[model samples]
Target: MAFDNFYYCVLYEKKYSDYFLYQCILLWMCRKTKSSVTEQQPDSSAIHTISTLPDTNQYLYDFLKMVLADQKLQYSYGLSQEVKNCLYVESDEVYLSRFIITPPQTNPYDQNPSGVDSTKLIYNTDSSVSVNISAQLILNTLTLLPNHACLKKSDITYMMAEKSRLHNLKWNNQKTGFSLTNKNNWYTFSLPYFSKDKKKAFICIQSLCPGLCGSGDVLLYQFKNNKWTSQKVDSWLH
Candidate 1:
C-alpha cells in the first residue's frame, strides 16, 4: 500500500548532518502503510497470513554482543548498546513478532539488513529510553530499553515534526483513539486485552542490515487510565 500521491522533501537542521537528524524525518514521512483499515475476509478467497521469524534473530542483548565484540570493549562504547539500555521490557515477552508480508526491496550486497532498520526511542512523563534493533523480519525485530540507557538528553530520542515549534512528537491516545495532549511512541499495538503502547507494554523490530544491520526497536510503555507506568527487565537473544 504505497502512496503514489506522496509528498517528499528535505530539511536542513544546521545542528547535525543531513543524514543524522533527518533520518527519523524520512522514516516518519515515508513510513509504510498499514494493511487495509478493514481486513479481508478469510474465505473461499483464502484471505489469511501464516507467519514466521528468521532463525538468525538478534534481540537487543545479542546486538550488544555484536557491538561490543572485542572482549575488552564495554557496552557503553557501542552506540546501539547504549541506546538499548534506555528501553525497558519484560523478559517473558521478548519474542519475534511476525508482520504481514510485503514485497522485498533491493538491498545492496554490502547491506544485509535483518529486521527493522529504524531506531525507536521511548519517552515517559519523567524518563526516556531508546531501543535500537537489527532484524530481517518485518515485525520480529524490536525490543525494549531502560531510562538509564537514554544517556544524553540531546540524543536522537524524541523527534520533532520537521516544522513543529514544540519539542515533543505529539500523537493520539491509542486506548481512547482521541487526540492526546502528550506525544508518545513505541509502536502502539494490541494483544488480546493488553495495550502494548510505547509508554512499556509494546515492542517492534524495523531493520536488519549487516555490520550494523539496518535495525529497528520497539518502545513499549504502560499507560493505565491515561497515566504512564514504569518497569524493567534484562537479557538477550541471537
Candidate 2:
C-alpha cells in the first residue's frame, strides 16, 4: 500500500488519535521525498573529465633539457643517483613571481626618484637584464595560464607527474634520499618566456625534495652560434 494512503487510513481510525497520526504523515512524506531525490540525483564519481594539455612546443622542451643538464643544477641537490633519477618534472608550467619583476612605472603619482621609464619593463628580479618581450604581454600570458595552460606528457623527455605525487615517496634515514621503493621527488620549471626575436629566453627552475633538499634559480639563456648558454639572473638555495 502507498504510504500516503496508509497514513490516511490510520488518521481515519479514532483510536490512532491526533499526535500519532500527524507524526506518521510527516514520516511518510519525508521518506517519499528522500527516495525520490536520491533516484533523481546523479552519481558524481561516475562522471569523468578528460583534460587536454597544450601542444608540444619544441623550444620549451629544449630549454628544459638544457637547464636540467646543467652541472650546477644536477650536483647542487646533494642527492644520490637513485634519488636524482626519481626527479619528476611537473606537468603544468608555472611562473615564479619572486624571480620575474616589472620595474616601477614612470607615472607622476608613483615614486619616480630613479625616474625609471614605464616603457622599460620586463627586467630580471635584480633589474639587471631587460628582456625584449612586452611586460604587459608576458604578464597577461602568465596570469591566464592558471586557467588555460598545461604541459603534455609527450612534451617532456623526463618522467612527468603532478607535484602532489611527491608525497608518495618514502624518505631514507638521512632524508637526502628516497627509499628504493619510492616513486619520485619533484622539480618545476616556468615556461620559457622568450624575447621577441627568439634569441633570448628567461626561465625559472625549482628542485624540491622531502626535508631540506632544494634549490631554485631564474636564468637567462642566450641563443648564439646554434647553441644555448645560460647565465644566472636570480637564485635561492637550501
Candidate 3:
C-alpha cells in the first residue's frame, strides 16, 4: 500500500540589501485514511501516528532535490548546498531543513550583485501537499563584555515600553520581548561596565525588527541617581 501521509519543514536564511530574512515552512499531505469500518463508526486500528513511521531523511532529501530541479533561483548553488546541510528527519515523520546565504562580494565599485527571483512550486507526494510558510527577521548573537550583566526580563520590558513612548514608536508591553534563542522577534539586553567603580553600567539592548526585512538596533542606557537615562552610541547596520 502507498504511504499514508507526508510532512515537510523548510527553513532558510537569506541576506540581501543589508537585511537577513529567515523563513520556515511546514507542509503536510492532508487526507483521511480509508477504514474497513463504516464512516459513522471510528476504527482505532486504522489510525496511524507519525511516531510509528521510520526515519524519513532520505525521502525528504530526494524530494527537496526534485523540487529544486524545477526552480530557477539565483544563488542556486549556495542555496542547494545549504539545503543539503540543513535537511534532517525528526522522529515524528517531520522533515526539517535550514540554510543560510551570504553574498559573494560586497563591493559598490564592482558589478551589481544578482538578485534572486522568488519561485513557488507545487510538490506532489501521495495526493495533494499542503504548505505553510513563516518568515521573521534574523536575530544576531551579542557577546557580553567583561564585567557585564544582562538585565532582567521585567526591566527590559519596562525599558522598552518607555523607549517606545519617548521615541513615538508603536510598541506593546506584552509583545515586546526577548529570548536566548533566535526563534522569535525579541531584544536581548546586557549591562556593560560604565564606571570605574562598577556601580553604574551601560545597558546594551540588541534587537531585530519584527518583519522579515528590517534593520537591527542597539540601544544604550545608563542608570544613575535612581533613574534610567538613555545615552547616544554609534551603531552600524550591514
Candidate 4:
C-alpha cells in the first residue's frame, strides 16, 4: 500500500480498523525487503552454462594457454608458487564493467592530451582511436563463453561454481589457517567483452593464493590474421 493511503487509513478510515492497516504495512515492508535483496544480487544472466557457444569455447581455450605461458607471469611466481597442478577456476562468467576506466571530464585543457598510446586501454585519452566498445554489446551473456568443462583443457582443477569454490576455501582455512597454500589458490575469469565487429575483446582474470600472493589483470585481445594478440589494459597485485 502507498504511504499516503496508509496515512489516510490511520487518520481517517475506521471501518477497515487496525487489523487492515497492519496487514497493509506488513505487505509494504515485505515488498521493500524483497526489492533490496534483488538489487544486491549479481546479474542472473552471468550464472548460465557456456557449452552452447562453440566458438567462445575455442577462444577461451586458446586465450588461457596464452596466459599460462606468459613469461612475465611465470617470473612473478615465488619459490612456493605454481600455476599448474591444483589450480581452481571459478565456474561463472564475470562482467568487465567493474574494471572500466573512468577519467575526470571537468578539465577542458586536458581533453586532448598527446603522447597517449593507442594500443593501451586508456579511457578518454584520444577520441578518434579510443576503445569505445558499448556496454550492452560487451555484456552479452549469449556469447558461448567458458565454464569449468571448457577450461578442462588445462591440467588444473575447476570448481563447479562459486559456492563450491568458497566452501573449499573455508574448509582449507579452518584446516590450515591460511598458512598453507595447498589447493587454496584460485582463479576467476570475466566473460570476454567483444567489440562490435568481434575482432577485438577485453577480459579480466584474477588469481588469489594463500596470504599475500594475489594478482589480477584486464587484458585486451585483438584478432589479426587468424591469431589473437593480447596486451595489458590494467593490472593489480597483492
Point to the candidate with the largest lDDT.
2
Model 3 misplaced stretches (Cα beyond 4 Å): 1-184, 209-220
Task: Give the TM-scores of the predictions, in the order they appear.
Answer: 0.16, 0.32, 0.20, 0.31
| Model 2 Cα lDDT, one tens digit per residue, 74-190 | 433433332222111332233322223345444453334543434446457767544343223222234522221122323221213322333233323242222433324555455
In candidate 2, stretches whose alpha carbon ends up further than 4 angstroms from where it belongs are: 1-55, 71-184
lDDT of 3 by residue, 52-144 (tens): 666433333333232223222122111111111111122111210111122343433323244222334557655554543322223435645
RMSD of 1: 36.3
The lDDT per prediction is: 0.31, 0.50, 0.31, 0.48
Model 4 misplacement above 4 A: 1-59, 70-182
Local error of candidate 1 at residue 34 (angstroms): 46
Best by TM-score: 2
By TM-score, the candidates rank as: 2, 4, 3, 1
Give lDDT tens digits, candidate 1, residues 1-238: 1343232222233445767658887676555332332344355334332334432322323332322242223222112211122222532222212211235455332233453455547676777766655554344334453332321221122211111222232322331232233222222211211222222233332322234334344433355687644332222332
State which candidate, 1 or 2, has the greater TM-score: 2
- What is the Å distance of residue 41 in model 3 from its true position? 61
